[model samples]
Target: MENLPKGSPKLINAWAFYDWANSVYSLVIATAVFPIYYESVTSSNGGMVDFLGITLPNSSLLSYSLSFSFLIVAFLSPILSGIADYSGNKKSFMKFFCYLGSLSVISLFFFRDTNTLWIGILATILASVGFWGSIVFYNSYLPEIAFPEQHDRVSAKGFMFGYTGSVLLLAFNLTMIMKPEWYGIMDETLPARISFLMVGIWWMGFAQYTFHYLPSNVYNRKPRKDFIFKGVKELKEVLIGLKKLTTLKQFLIAFFLYSIGVQTIILLAGIYGKVELGIETSQLIITILLIQIVAIFGAFLFSRISERIGNIKTLKLTIAIWGFICFAAYLLDKDNKYIDIQFYALGGVIGMVLGAIQSLSRSTYSKLLPETEDHTTYFSFFDVTEKIAIVLGTFIFGFVGSITNSMRNSIFILAIFFLLGYIVLSFMKKIEPVK
Candidate 1:
């Protein structure tokens, strides 16, 4: 692979702008608006609802839907990524998923009643696949667009942009939700639905800035007519090469271990607060907004810390902090006199590490990669690990909560995943940063 030029602030900023585009999906659809909306629409009578042929609890239904979506992505991303690398069309693939996800978000407007519950379920699945699928190609751009020394800062900048942009949109949505009458709308559901539409538009519109700057292929490969077969051949080569890339493999193992805890917690926090702790919807939104607001600073702060102490140690610090968060969460209860305060405290801690861990992990993986043209294929493996971890995490969390009828124990159990991540990191052979 040829070494591409880097240090272009304009290109870096343009690439980072995609985060500003897509993050509304994470905040508005996945984390905030959609879950609450789903519960309100599906759990209408406060009883089990019939989904397809099966009757299941509303929370379990959502969890299973998300797990199933991640499973699909995990299976498909590597093959698609291989095609993308061979075809020199990572940007186009990213754009395709962006459109699919955004359009699905807009389709969610019609999911207003129990009869249309399938719309919400199906849209959520498609929207999630769109978002996460786009991410595999997006993350591949890091090594090609920025120098190794700049990876931590650039990755954090992207995340910071995401956190700030999503927080702004989520805050606006919260206002519309909490004070629907202010907008001359009588039905609160109308504003929530409108927020979903806004997310779709916001995602596609800002993404054009990135699409304009990101090249079709940084390596400038000219794939032949047999590119489809070539793509599979390349992926097979990468899989075989993995045996010799011990450092990269070890880091991915550590990453997979921690993501099981981190991603699941992010996905489930709002629901757990609402269902288990009896927190109000408005309060949950406010708390999530707070986490995003703090995460911006956390991303920036931890990037600097990684610069000082090195990426490996910085990631270990985050792993330790996350484990503590799980233990602290286990102690929280609905009946406590200061339950809200404790919940907020947990949110604060989550805010502190959320961006730090994510930013550091991405940059760290980029640092660990060998100089190769198959970046999309390699990053596909990275994304696949996380998606599968999410599947496991959500499945375990939901299965435990269902059987025990308690979210607390489910949350506490996640501490073990973090501990395993920390131990794996401890043993990982540190590769020197790319010069």
Candidate 2:
């Protein structure tokens, strides 16, 4: 492939458009509608879910399933990313997972009742793997499409698009669930089922606009018959290279620590609100929407702040706030008179830092990567790092919640992770631009 010139507004926008395409899965299926739907279903069944012939608490089962999916992504990313780099087919590998994820989402339309519990859990796991697997390739594109200095703004733009697109679809879905009769649907579950269908359609349909413009085979490598093994070799090289990139290695350590808190919080916040705070479905949905709306502003606002304070400092600030959020969440009690108000207030703070930290983390890591053509392999490491963090975090959160019968205890554990991540970030030196 030709060496495409960087800083092309048209090209960069095309790349960012993928976020608008796929984020529906994040907000609707991963973050909102499905989790609530899963809980509501199992709660009606004596608050126990039958998982692979064993009954488990509904939250524990869901957490384990999600943790398993992230573990798959972590295992697959390194090898798959190597093949993509060696074959010069990064876009193809990305497209494969995008369709895998989107189609799996559409298949959720069949998950109608408790007896079909396996379908919901299996489909959710596959869709999650698809969503996260594609992200490895998608993130590898940042350094290729933009100069290092442009990384922050470009990364924030993608997230801004994501937050906006997901919120629009979620708002529409919430309306259908709140008033099903307006659509002539009497089936109590049909509204959410249709939302599942809509999310799949939205994800696949918008992605075409990105696929049409995104470059394929950018490196134009011609792989030999041994390309399969060549891919594994690519991973080994990155592992060796990381030893010299001390700051980047240090940043990943800090990122892993904080992500255990950040991702666990994002994944379980809905359940915590439902069971711990006794928040109604309507209030919980509204709070998530509020977080998404606030996150749009947060993404760009922190991007601007990073221009003055630099990425490391901005990230440290966000991590500090995340630690505060964890402690604040632990304090929320259902017996309180102003429980809903306090939860909403806490949601405001979560919204402020959620997108800021995420966008900055991706861009900051992109800026730190050394100049090389094996970007897919390199970013795979970053992707694997976070996915592994998710696995550990979710597993711990679920284990603690199941044993103690209190998710609040899980939140308290996450607070310590954030604190540890904050302390690690203090040692990171200012990074120089990759020449």
Candidate 3:
């Protein structure tokens, strides 16, 4: 491993390209196709899913499964990231997760019947874990790959690639699934199943470009035979160090608060539209595509804004808008004549802030990390924070929807989380470039 130049465009683009490779899982499996497919399948099968030998509302079951998977990853990331850093094999670890995730996605093609419902839920959980687990190591590379000053723009570039790449694939998938007759396919399920297979191949195939270029071990550390226990020691050291890093600590708190709302919205938005609001499958797909398209501009636009107004201020603005989105969501009702139009309007606002918040959050946290070779350990903490937030958010969203039998109240409840996040951000100091 050599000390690579900080601003090498080739290396940076290689790093960004991984986003292109992996984001199909996000758009297709997590956000767009699978959730809608899951809902449609479950709804047709008596609206009750058999999970762990118990029958439950399909929506609640899916939400709880997601919450459970994220919880497992959040607990494991710190230790696993510690080992990757110690062994100087973060890339290997990342690849392992990618394989796990992509393969799990491909396996979903087998999940077509009510009796196979467990396979869908189990596969979804593993796929999510694989995707998110890789992200911990992937994010750790930011501080090593780019100078702190370049963090915002570089992060935005990665997200922009992600949006564009996922949109391209998703649009193709949409055409095949939504209008099967146009493709001369009488079975709608066949195309959707094929989309799953395509996502796995796309994820693993494009990732080769990233793997070809990214350095295997930039620091080139040689771990001792006791590396496993030493990894735990490294993780403990990072935990102790974080207690004294007041600025980073505060930002993590704020991030956790906002993520509760933001992540829940992303994971559940399609399902919410389909089941609760009675939005057509075609309309939902179009709305998600609109988000991906608009998000490219949003990522670049907010990157510049952050440069001009500062990261903290930029983030504050985004969080406030997220709160407003929640409030607006509360007002949407199926009885309204312009319900579809209102939903699209919500999608527009979601797009405007979605990429901005994600890119900015990653860069801001990267900038805040202390000077150390334990990049993976630090980032694991960041990843864990958001993962736990997702757990809490999904659990509460599902719980509320279950008890009340309405998703609107769950949407309204999420608004307070964004408000709390905004208030916490007010106390965070401006970020200084890491020397």
Candidate 4:
């Protein structure tokens, strides 16, 4: 593998390109089309599913499945990332998961209807694990590819790539779905299933550009026969390392709190729109598309803002807006006049912060790290923190919706998390990454 010098533009952009490759899964499958498809399928089947021998509402079942996937990532990343760090194989680990996720997404084409619900559920879980699992290693590369002063711009650049790439593919997907006749498809469900296959293909096909450019192992370390045990030892050492880094620990606490709300909102917004507000599928997807379009600007704008105000304040600003979004969401009901317009307005607001916060959060964590080569091990903690938060958030969303039969109730409760995050963030001492 060719080694690029540190902080080179080509190297940084190549790292960012992976976001372009993989974010289609996040937008198309996790956020927009697949959830709507799942909802329609379950709605036709009396809105119920039996999974693991327990009957659950279709929406709740999907949320629970996502929560389960996050749980898997949370548990597995620490070990795998430690191994990647020790063996200098982080890129390999990333490719393995990417292939796993893309293949699983392709298999979702087999999920034709309620009868193949297991295919849908199983594929959803595996694909999610693949996307997020690969993300841990991908994120670990940030500090390696960019100077500290440039982390915000580089991170935002990645997200802009993600937003732009995802939107283009989703636009294509939406056209296929809305106008199935253009493709000579009369089956209502077949269009969505085809979209699923395309998402898989898009995810795998586009990733090759990144894989081609990215160096496999900068460290050049070889694994021993006891690499697994060595990896576990590294995991233990990072825990001790975390205990010494007070600011990073504090930031993780705040990040975890806010993520419970932010992640849950991203994952469930489609369901909330469809189930809680009775939004039409086309309108809901269009609103989500609007968010992706807006998020590109949001990421670029906020990255520049972070350079001026610093990452922590930028994050606090984004979180404040998130708090507003949660409250506004709780206020929405199906009975409101011009409800679609209101939803679109909220989608616009979400767009403004969605990419900004996610990009900033990753860079902020990167900037705060004590100088170390075990970036993957350190970032595994970060990814684990996020995955655990998502797990809790999705579980709460599902459990509350199951009990109250209204996801609006979940929205109301999630706002409190942001408030707590805001308070916790204030306690983190302001420090410049490059000072």
Candidate 5:
């Protein structure tokens, strides 16, 4: 493992630009505007229309489709990760996924009121698969780029840049859609569609910087082999790694359990505000903008705190804060006009902790895993747990909301997850990074 060139601004910028590129998908399509647009397009005029003689809210159908997409991503991610590792083509695989995702985002412009439901659903599934699949390889590259000692700072910096990039793009897109009159755009929807197109262009354009500057790994002891059999072998090795976690198994278990609450909030925060709290779409976009803006400062703050108190202590504090946030969500009024203020405040708190949790967690787990040529294969299990946690958390929220008809009540259940995870994490031994 050679050291990356110190103060190589191009290398750092290139790595960070990948974050910049992918975050557009997260900000524009996944979070702010598209879900609302999907609901609007699918809505009926208060009629019990039969789809195969079964009546359902268009929103429910959308949620179901989203959940199904997660399921497919969960199943395919590790397999694809294994294939990438075996072929030593993680970079190519990432590019393919990025292209698929960005193309799908741009194609959202074609989804009009007259578009078929299947078209929207198919697009969502393709985009989700690409987004989630690409992350496995992307995260694996962290250790390759930065040494163990530098992982925390470098990873945090990447996240900070990502949040900043997301905010910058979201600001432009929000202005276009929210104040189309000022921009001389006749139709608000046209700007919204153009916003999606911008995400694709931004993602495609910035990715080239990374591909140009980052050196490809050249150490190869074995020739390229059959991808199918190699993927299976890698999958078996991952399962074996999970089973071999004798002392650190408790830490992995805690991460797996607690991540459910973390992922649920990330995925559903915008939808919760728009649907349950009756927040206007523009207000919801502004709230997300605030999250990204505050998160930049928050990452720096946590980096300083971790320097003083250590990563484990900072993480413990973050878990405690998450518990309180979940409890606060339950207390917020479902119909309160001031609910957006509460959400904005909550987003601030989340911003303060998000980078710390992700950066520290990655560094901590990298220390725990064995040194292997197939590091990405093993890391795929970590990725799998994350996706599965998200799937389960979303499923739980949706199930509870459907049954109880209250998002607040469903949020109360998240506190239990946080508390249990905190307790589990407290018991695990401190992780020491490899020298």
Candidate 6:
């Protein structure tokens, strides 16, 4: 592999483009636009509360749904990943899931007013599952394309490009919102739906570059005739791998716990701003824009910091920053005059830490794996833990907010997760990369 040029510009560009492609889902559908639209369409005339089976508000229900969806994915992703690995069809599985997610996101266009709340919710669930399932294979491809030495740089580059792509589309979508009259869209809702469609189109269009440039690894063995049974066998092996994780049990436990907090923060940031702080929808979009813009520079900055302090130390620093951010969020008041300032500060802090935490974690985990043949199985475990974290964090936050009627108070509890993670991370000795 070294005899071949490390990675060509085209290969790198193609790799980064996938990040650009899928980030539309993250920026528009997951974080900024869709949640606001969902709340608006689903809420009562009061414009804040929703009517689920119980009398829960839209914000609370959305949080609960997000958490529930993550829990479902946590149980299922390992099984899917095992199937993909046993079939030697990771790319095929990625493409199938991408289409499923994209189609589900586009289906959001049909959900109008409060009439089809269940339809909207179902679409969201399917899209969320597709988005997450595709990422399992997407992330598994990292080691295949780049050698160990280039992993951090390549991962950093992919994240930076993702932020850039999301920001670009966001800038366009924001313009459409700011000047809806110019686009001849009668209602605000139409344009938002159009924006969702745009994400699907953009994802499908740009993804072709990666599909064309990134060659699949050659497997000399013929696929098993009874692929279903083969998948089952592989899944059994995956369970055995999970059992072996007991050797690094402490680190795994800490990662699982802290990730819940991190996932909650990412999933609920937009809702928290709009619902808790009463920030305008436009302002929420702008705040996300700020995060993406700053995140590009932050990625580079944190990369340098990781070089100096080591990835583990850098991650600990981020955890400390996250704790402070959570405390500050909890302190916000209903008046909301300082809401924008708080969001901007949070965005900046997150931008600085986000890249470091993700890249370092991936690099660190890659070093600790038992073998290359088990990469898909091990990474599937990683994906499951990630979903589990999201499930716990989102569930706890949503459950607490619903019971107490205070999003701010719920946010304060998140600090404990970060603090605990930081403490555990400090005791961990970094593993050397396996040759």
The reply for model 2, stretches above 4 Å from the true place, is 1-4, 402-405
Give per-residue lDDT, candidate 4, residue 330: 92
Pairs in steric clash, model 3: none
For this target, which candidate reaches the highest lDDT against the unseen true structure? Answer: 3
lDDT of 4 by residue, 208-279 (tens): 877777878777888898999998898888889889888899899999999999999987888789888999
275: Cα error in model 6, Å: 4.0
Better of 1 and 2 by lDDT: 2
User: Model 5: per-residue lDDT, tens digit, 1-435?
Assistant: 223463465566677678877887887788777776776666666522234456677766666667777778677777877776777777777888888888887777776763455566677778877787777777777666666666667677877878888888878887787789888999646887788789878877887777766555523435354777877788787777768776456667778777888889888887777777777777776777887777777777776776777766777888898888888877877567778788788888877777667766776676666666566676677777887788799889888988999888778888788888888877764666433
| Per-prediction backbone clash count | 0, 0, 0, 0, 0, 0
RMSD of each: 2.3, 1.9, 1.9, 2.0, 2.9, 3.0
Ranking by lDDT: 3, 2, 4, 1, 6, 5
Per-residue lDDT over 1-435 for candidate 3, one digit per residue giving the tens place of the 0 to 100 score: 444476789889999999999999999988888877887788865798777889888977887777787888899999998888888989999999999999999999988878788889888898989999989989999998898999999999999999999999998998898788888997757888889999999999999888887788888899999989989988999899989988889999999999999999998888788788889888888899988888999999999999999999999999999999988888889889899999998999899999999999999999988888999999999999999888889889988988999999999999999999999999876888544
Q: Which stretches of candidate 3 lie over 4 Å from their true place?
A: 1-4, 402-405
**Which residue pairs clash within candidate 6?**
none
In terms of TM-score, how similar is model 4 to the real structure? 0.95
How well does candidate 6 match the true structure, expressed as C-alpha RMSD?
A: 3.0
Report, for every candidate in turn, its global Cα lDDT versus the true structure. 0.88, 0.89, 0.90, 0.89, 0.74, 0.75
- List the candidates' TM-scores in order: 0.96, 0.96, 0.95, 0.95, 0.91, 0.90
> At residue 37, what lDDT does model 3 achieve?
85
lDDT of 2 by residue, 93-171 (tens): 9999999999999988988878888888999999999999989999999988888889999999999999999999999
